[model samples]
Target chain A: MKAVLGTMGDEVKVFGFWASPFSRRVELALRFKGVPYEYIEEDILGNKSPLLLHYNPVHKKIPVFLHNGKPIAESLVILEYIDDTWKSNPILPHDPYDRAMARFWANFIDDKCFPAFMKAVMGPENEREKAVEEAGDCLKTLESALNGKRFFGGDAIGMVDIAANFIGFWVRIIQEIAGVELLSADKLPALFKWTDEFVSCSVVKESLPPQDKISAAFKARIDQAQTNTRP
Target chain B: MKAVLGTMGDEVKVFGFWASPFSRRVELALRFKGVPYEYIEEDILGNKSPLLLHYNPVHKKIPVFLHNGKPIAESLVILEYIDDTWKSNPILPHDPYDRAMARFWANFIDDKCFPAFMKAVMGPENEREKAVEEAGDCLKTLESALNGKRFFGGDAIGMVDIAANFIGFWVRIIQEIAGVELLSADKLPALFKWTDEFVSCSVVKESLPPQDKISAAFKARIDQAQTNTRP
Candidate 1:
């Protein structure tokens, strides 16, 4: 069977949870690329629907992208698929080396900053400061990567920015509730500027979750963490 | 400047350490694609070379691929770059969905299996058994993803196979030194068979480190873990 390339008439659906950063990556990619799709919200915090299970038995996580009827899991993989399928507003750089660099930074965001951010905000009280320092180091490295450019991908936002939506939007809200200071203009001015530009973009501005809802959700998480860590 | 989409005359070089499975991924890819290049061995166990640091300052890890002076780091990113540059052998699947699946499982091996395998072999004494069980589960999930196919990418070894090189070759050696039993013909028959088939391929066979050297290398690692854990 011939592989169906991206057709405007393709049946594209996204299985995603409301507050997942990974799911938001997929959403931002679609919105950035001007693709049309139906959104199916999964209650991932509670029970994952049978449909999600059917589509993604291995990971059983959200942001499962379906083109026609086939499912693609993993946010990075789905982002690449979306780019491959729809070539108009490119999610990646045209140059192979540039594409490789974009991928490297995107994975860096996932592997380094996200973990450090989680640790800084929710780790044991004794280790919180060290985790904050480590998280700052990761952000500083990332800031260097930004390198005076308007975005990680240069003038326009690309996959790296999409991968970093949490850093741009979610962290600001979560940091206040968690009493952690990781991302801000004083420490990482370039990244802070990029976040401002990224979230301000209409495509991102309209889709980012409501500030109050995210605050409520993450507040519950911090409360849970504190309860769990009680001496 | 026009992007160089892989010219046969392009200067290619691979900076890698001998025992690293990630570095080996890049080696297998170049050999499988029949791309010729210079190999620079780095003494990663001791001190890293200035050149490696110069090329990849961010991660400062090996398996830095240089194509006409531009460096690409991160094993998976380098794999994609190689595939993108050279059109002949096609490192990734042509079909977009199939490509997505390949990327998904490749990352699964890295993200899920690698750490679990490390813990199984090198973790503290009491945690070893549970780590082994968790490692087995990861392998079992990977086995299911194999899905009766001769290779993870249908009949041929692809990125997933390359990514699982540690599982295929390194784990078999490391497990013996560490005195653990995880991957085997009885437990995961398909993956066992795939490993046999994978290593037998001339390209993989020739590039894979000699068993004696790997055994010696991993023995030192296991010994180091024992020393560190001896409180």
Candidate 2:
């Protein structure tokens, strides 16, 4: 899809937040490709560094990857770039049609799954039930995409699976903190299995943060949501 | 990015809506690559054909590009697939970083511009102003992407330019039909200029619909929206 030759001299820097699935997506690609990169954690919630702003002036968002000081914004864009530059451990399928399918589903996950799943857990009380139903429908569709493959990329973590990191890892913690469960073995067995398979992957394991850290961050989020919702 | 060898025997079928930017994107890429294909105009706003349903079972949407019976859905996905399969008239840049930027801006057009711009034109009266502000902001950012280039692709119509077909052509008609002025020479000179440059290209001119036809279609849409908005 997109990479460069990974070496000590390669000027690879990742501007990311500790908890953003977007930033972790960049790290996952680099690690999967065995690319060494200097990681800079951003104060995403408070103040982004001037450098981060400079790199991604338009979006000014995290998961901005820099190669030789040139910035690549958007995590999926960065993923493809890494895949192309490194040439090894290809994230996208070689076949063009399959690659298109991968990109489509990856987009569906980001554009559909994230919002619905997040709302199912974190949205207003009045809307949570509807979001849960919507999120379940999305999970059903996603489970079908597995089609008995071990991963969306088939037998390994690929672009679609990486693009779905939020549902795999963060949702597990966030849903627990919010006392909601939209994704489960009973409802979406394939996706449920994928969650474990993805997070347990030796390569993905390194990119994931401690579960407790995620729990604490989301716990604070829940408290803030409750405070904001209070009359 | 992607392509195929085009000839009489190649079974390249495009299931598209005549006025849909998404479907038109697929057509634009094919025309750019000199690929020969059958174009089936779908009744997208009505009952979608069984073939369209069968081709893209997941999204059940238009711009389904079928190559020798293999289906590729999503306009952007199909666009890249066309670029890869054709091999001639490359739609994407060869450089990995440039390719990534192209992908980013393409997604930005579909994900950000379309929704914001559409809402500005078609949403409820109360929401139109906010959407106008939002759509304006979005256009400002897009104008920056031009960055003095004749097109987002530079010198010729490329992925970004083709991807922006909606804003380049449809908006000129839609905004006028909706009695709104979101994009204009005075407001966004670069994007304003890009619209003409993109649509006037011989390759794109073949794909665009007649202005009267677009006017008639959207005139009906505005009437429907008004009826729905009435007490």
Candidate 3:
């Protein structure tokens, strides 16, 4: 697999925080492309790294990709930059329509699914049922999109799959902490199978943080949220 | 200019509502590309067109671009598809980093600017001030991104410019109705000038709805929202 432009020694670095799904998305994309780089973990909740602040002044969030010392922030945009800059094992489909569809789904997962999932986990007690219902609907919609395909991009993992990394791994852990079953195998068989396959895929298998660590992080977040709301 | 892949006579259609900034973004992109498309206005609040519902079942929202009978929803995604499918007068910058920057700004406008603007208009009386402040911050961030560039892409209107269509025209009108001035020239001088130039650009000029109609529409919406919440 030849480098897209053979600027072989160009520095490629990723600024990320462990347990952040968005950060994992970028790391997964870089790994998929076989791009080597240093990964700097940021203290996102505490004092954020000054380099992260300098690189991503607008959002100041990770994962910011630093290529040849220039920064690119936002996980989805970083994924596109990775694909465009280093094209080995292309993650996006070639057809214009297919590419658009992939982007559309990725945007959907980001804009709709993530929020709904969070609401189910963190909404007030009275609204938790509605939030769970909405989250379930989002999963069902995603399952329909998969339609028994091997992956969201069909036959292999691609951009949409990476964008939806949470559904493939994080959701179940989140559900466990929230004491909900929104994405159970019985509820979304196709999606569950896809998740299994996605998590086992070579690069993704190594890229994801261990489940116990993620579970502990989530518990801490939920506890902190509850503590903040206590009057 | 030759068509990218000469699917001559391809049926390109746009399902949109006249007042929607998102819809206008897609229309402007098509016009810039010199691609002929039939625009179907959906009665979004009344009875949504079955076609829109069918095409964008998940979101059930407007700005669905149907190319050769396949529907692609999400305005930014549609813009990219239009650019990829019709290569004339390319709307996105060619460099991958530039493209990523364009997308980052576009995503910023969508994820940050639009929400803050909405909060300014429709938030509770107590929260309006905070909302306005946040919206102003978003504008200042956008102004910084422009940084005296003629357009977001430098020298020409491009994807980021198209994605920020709301800020270019809709924001001023929305400000008038909301009785707040978040995009004032004194505060956002660069953004104000960009908006003036953007709205007057040949393609964008024709794509936007008439000012009087949009003003009346927004007024009605704000009035109705207030009426609904009255004690």
- Measured by TM-score, the strongest candidate is 3
| Interface RMSD after interface superposition, model 3 | 0.5
Badly placed stretches (over 4 Å) of model 1 are A1-7, B1-7
Which candidate model has the greater TM-score, 2 or 3?
A: 3
Tens digits of lDDT, candidate 3, B1-231:
337543467788999999999999888887877777899999999999888889999889998989878999999998888888888888888888899999999989988989888878876667778988999999999899998799987999999898888889888998898789888789888999999999889888878889999999989988877666555
Task: Give residue A69's lDDT in candidate 2 (0 to 100).
Answer: 84
Taking all chains together, each candidate's TM-score versus the true structure is 0.95, 0.95, 0.96
Best by lDDT: 1
TM-score, chain A only, candidate 3, equals 0.95
Candidate 2 runs further than 4 Å off? A1-4, A226-231, B1-8
Alpha-carbon shift of residue A24 in model 3 (angstroms): 0.7
Fnat for model 2? 1.00
Error of 3 at A214 (Å): 1.8
Ranking by DockQ: 3, 1, 2
* Highest-scoring model, DockQ: 3
Comparing 1 with 3 on DockQ, the higher-scoring candidate is 3
lDDT per residue, candidate 2, B104-124, as tens digits?
999888878888887787777
Candidate 3 wrongly placed segments (more than 4 Å): A1-7, A226-231, B1-7
